[model samples]
Target: MPLALYLLALAVFAMGTSEFMLAGLLPDLAADLGVTVGAAGTLTSAFAVGMAVGAPLMAALARAWPRRATLLGFTLTFAAAHAVGAVTASFPVLFATRIVAALANAGFLAVALTAAAALVPADRKGRALAVLLSGTTLATVAGVPGGSVLGTLLGWRAAFWAVAVLCLPAALGILTGVPADRGRRETSGGPALRVEFAQLTGVPLLRAMLLGALVNAATFAGFTFLAPVVTGPAGLGEWWVPVALVLFGAGSFAGVTVAGRLADRRPGSVLAVGGPLLLLGWPALALLAERPAVLLALVFVQGALSFALGATLITRVLYEAAAAPTLAGAYATAALNTGAATGPLIAAAALTTAAGVLGPLWTSGLLVAAALLTALPARAATTPGRNPEAAR
Candidate 1:
């Protein structure tokens, strides 16, 4: 509830915009860089890979640094990555910038979640995280679509520069607003690898992570290819692409809002009921891609359900891993980014098939359906209804 929490969320907004804006920029980037669209889609995966690795690695390395300093460094690095990306003429150079940006994004997010939880009461962790994640949802509404519009008009480079410039104010806000004394007690040695491994391998925590990652994998798989879907198969104009993104983003904002209210109380029921609905959406979107109306309608539905389930699963991991406060952020980052990375990569491969852009939707459908096995035990949560009260 503190202003610092809002500052953290503001920083998250900039990060979220950069993280997701690529969905819109892909076609332009591919044409400009003289690569196949599938190759361009790899940029999303590249960023995800960086996040998956950088989250825990940076968390451990920066454990001894002041929280404010750590955040500032990551923010600056992220901003610089974008600046470099905007100017790069080579495809591989642009690809490398995405990795660096993702690493900075991952480290900041890994620390941000822990810092957010630390700022709020145990009972309020769910809502606090919701506020933090709202940045991403909101980015979908404004930033992602805006990037698409800019790419359509000014060029993809403009969007990248915008993201870089946005970070300047966010960095300033974090540097000043997050109090000097508001800190994680520094340790000479990082969190033990054994404890970190135990936390990851533990059944409940693992389940939470798996469920979260599966939902995200499915979500991003479809999301990464949304531009092509709207413009190509759906036979809409470039203008309609951002319109579709707006609908998805608006729905996502609503979903995360509801999840924040219920996740802490009913993590099981949330995932139980939401998972199937989320799964059903992908195939429906794919099968009906020719219908503009169906494509528009399902995009919103999928975004809402996918993110509600994702936010819940992610927040739940943070709660389940409460014993290891220092490692919690890293695990949270890894869980979320693992799905983000896997979904797009698989979907990108599908692009080369006869299905073309529609391949990502089928890819997402298959991934989530398979991911269902990972959440087999999450089905049991439907009966329990609420997480254990003591965990509060």
Candidate 2:
């Protein structure tokens, strides 16, 4: 991997921190904004919706621009959005900033994946994407826990300021680290938006994307409510929330690391094992969440399995859409965010019911099972000329 790829990972780390810090800050945010915790959670959905809507549109509009410039522009915009978020007192204003930040976040991720994929051989796109996404996993390990501590010690706004400070260096990294032509590809005569949409909407790609969405939804459903789950049934206090988050993040990092090595070699096999394991892990989490001794252990397992499946999903999508890898990568980003947006809503609704804290476990489990079914046909789709027929 080139230095530029790692720099792209750094950019992802900053964005990922911004994206996930809200999870740990939800209680503080709800209290500060005078909103219900469920309502406060909508801020997360807002960000995901923005990413789902903005990534492809931004990618299309900026397709003609140089990759390095596009990445730099988005990173600066993201940093500015965080600054706006840090100062906002009104809930609506804060919500708006999340949308703005997510837009930039989506664009940066889509372009970063394209750049990373372009830098490597076709055979290594899986590893390339995994390495790029490792930054996201690392953010969970470092950024989320760090943000939790910052939020606990200072305030929720301080976490935003911290993310803002982190972004400046990420922006500088992209501007100075990535070469002008580093993995740059000509986009002058690329497929138009409608054409790209038609290509991406193919059955194979759609199934792969749906699988991505479902699996991501499952991960977020559990993760979105994790703070409360730990404090309530898991028998941990507020101080231990960061510790739980750290354990989850550590597992995610390890999962992605191992998946990266295996994804390029046998993506189908990775998915075969990873997806089902995620399904199994959730029930285990649901069962163990009330037992403090075992709950943390299950959280780590679920976290690792969720991310491992994610790496395989990305690899499968890229393989299925080799004809238009850039757009495919962008669409994949959109798909994942679509799930990220929906998962919290589902988990929030579950919280309202008698299922309480454990509801997300069941919700996530069903989604993971659905994801597995959707993913099953993807291997056949990877074969040239078989995608359309195999999906049937």
What TM-score against the true fold does each predicted structure earn? Answer: 0.95, 0.95
Q: Which stretches of candidate 1 lie over 4 Å from their true place?
A: 188-194, 378-392
Q: Indicate the worst ten consecutive residues by lDDT in candidate 1.
A: 381-390
The lDDT leader among the candidates is 1
The C-alpha local distance difference test score for the whole of candidate 1 amounts to 0.86
Best by TM-score: 1
Candidate 1 local lDDT, 1-392, one digit each (tens): 88998998889999999888888988889999999888988898899999989998998787767899899999999999999999999999999999999999998998899999888888788898999999999899999999889998999999999999999999999989997787754564545656765787677788778777887888899998899999888899989988999999998999999999888878777777887787788989999999999899999999899889888888878877876777788888998999999999999888889988899999888877876777785565323333445444
lDDT (tens digit, per residue) of candidate 2 on 1-392: 88999999998998988887777899998999899988988898999999999878887777777888899899989989989989988999999999999999988888887778778877777778888998999999999999999999999999999998998898898889999965455665565566777777678788777888888889888888899988998888988888888888888888888888877666666677777788888888888788986988887888898888777777667666666755766887888899999999998898888888788778899899888776565556423332422311
Candidate 1 contains a number of clashing pairs equal to 0
